[model samples]
Target: MRLKGNLSQIKNSRDNQNVDVELYIDKIEYITNKKDGRYTQPFEFVDELDTPLVLTGDCLARVQDKHLEEGEFAYQVYDKVEGEYVLNPDKYLELTVAYDFDADLTILTAAYYTVTVSNEEFKDIKAERSKEKKQKKGKGRKGRS
Candidate 1:
């Protein structure tokens, strides 16, 4: 139910204004009831952005146009299970959101279909090179102890 990610205005190959939205999904937790068997379970999206990006009418229009031309922004949803961001096999989620040029990014409806990437695939999404540790030279006497 919660959406967290970066949304910005960028120029496409044609030099036209386009909106770029990428989410940094934290988790979608299940609310349980102990007393009775729960039938309806609701979830919410978490806002993990430090500083929100502002959307302009022109930008929003362009985004909509782009969406119509291409498709909705596919997002990768990650669920924090135990201590890691695990992926839910469910490929699509409905989220309704509004990008206001004058206000902080907020979801107006919370219902939009978004594509997701699995945890295993996410690791390969952005591979970072591990830094090699520097080996220390022995301080003992070079010729004698």
Candidate 2:
């Protein structure tokens, strides 16, 4: 899913400098399901930047550890420049929120993204199977008697 928004403000404190942005959810709950009387929802968030931003570092401050089934989750921040596009592994952070299904609580899946790009170029490209390939028939046939 894609989100569109602006970098409203930036806060620089004694501890650290954080960025504040806003984004609109074009599609919500893209992945989610209810199994065995439990509900799980997956959400994604992306930030659109007017100016190119560099990712120095990333860290997972906190993660939920209750009411969620064991699963792997990943989060990343991307930089789409005019000439090149790149993904920073150092900035690409991930966290796994796990919980036993037998627990009484429920697990909620969510993600946040910070994208720094000069402009918005919304392009939808879909890959389709080529029709040039032909199906092969069975080999070593006609072995009847």
Candidate 3:
């Protein structure tokens, strides 16, 4: 499976030090072996900033009687950054996943999860917006773009 999306933002979770990053997959394509049980996929990552970012995770798969187990899969991203590799958790990131499957199914199945980091200025702005929206009563607004 291939994923394409923007690295929305990095937000602090329960602990102010730990950040949770959001990624959106815009498009996914299936390539190769369209007739057989294999699946080929292509995807692109949309970055908010014009810089290089890194994403790291472990691949997982489980099959039971020719069927995949649902919700029993997860890809945990340990680090994500731009320009240089940093250990800090407060950063913004986005990425894409492309995969090939050698099975009898026309479509391949997979899941992805990520963490991200961003600069201080972007972080503050995101934080302020989050606060403002929460302060409102109704469902704030609609459609950012």
Candidate 4:
């Protein structure tokens, strides 16, 4: 499934480079047959070149949010070496009572999101950021009367 999310960060891709902006859905899973087990375990989104697609940062954060909304089940954790997303329960959230734990269990969960930007859109965002950066740099040299 193409899980849509907001963009968090991009690595390696540089200006003047024609990067193919690839996105991937590692896989999704549920515990106890929630939604009749709609997701497949270890789903792969690979290109014809065998390069696997990946999700990171905010992209993963969105996945966690989806799991919480579904049934507070598993989470998608990305493995950099494997270049895949793994569904894990260690990071899942709980809706139990406030005093159900030993006072050391963390109830506050952190989430993230990521989105793919088209090459044209990427250029636009880069240009706007460049303009803002130039303006900020110029502000440091002004003299008061």
lDDT scores in order: 0.34, 0.30, 0.31, 0.34
lDDT of 1 by residue, 1-145 (tens): 3333333332222112232444333333222222235564333222222343232212221122334322233333334457544544453333345666677555534434333344443333323211111112343437565
Clashing residue pairs in all predictions, respectively, total 10, 0, 9, 9
Lowest-sum lDDT 10-residue window in model 3:
57-66
- The collision pairs in model 4 are 6-114, 6-115, 7-115, 58-112, 58-113, 58-114, 59-113, 59-114, 61-112
lDDT of 3 by residue, 1-145 (tens): 2322211221222222222332333222211212234663332222232232323221111112223243232232233335433343322222222333565222223433332323444455456655655766346667566
Poorly placed runs, candidate 1 (over 4 Å)? 1-73, 100-107, 113-145
Q: Alpha-carbon error at 120 in model 4, in Å?
A: 0.4
Instruction: List where candidate 4 sits over 4 angstroms from the true fold.
Output: 1-111, 143-145
TM-score ranking, high to low: 4, 1, 3, 2
Q: What is the lDDT of candidate 3?
A: 0.31
Please report the candidate that would top TM-score against the real structure. Answer: 4
TM-score of every model versus the real structure:
0.24, 0.20, 0.21, 0.27
Candidate 2 ranges with C-alpha deviation above 4 Å: 1-69, 95-145
Cα lDDT tens digits for candidate 4, 13-108: 221121232244432212221133876333211112223344434213223345345323233333333643454423332221122257643332
Show pairs that collide, candidate 2: none
Candidate 1 TM-score, C-alpha based: 0.24
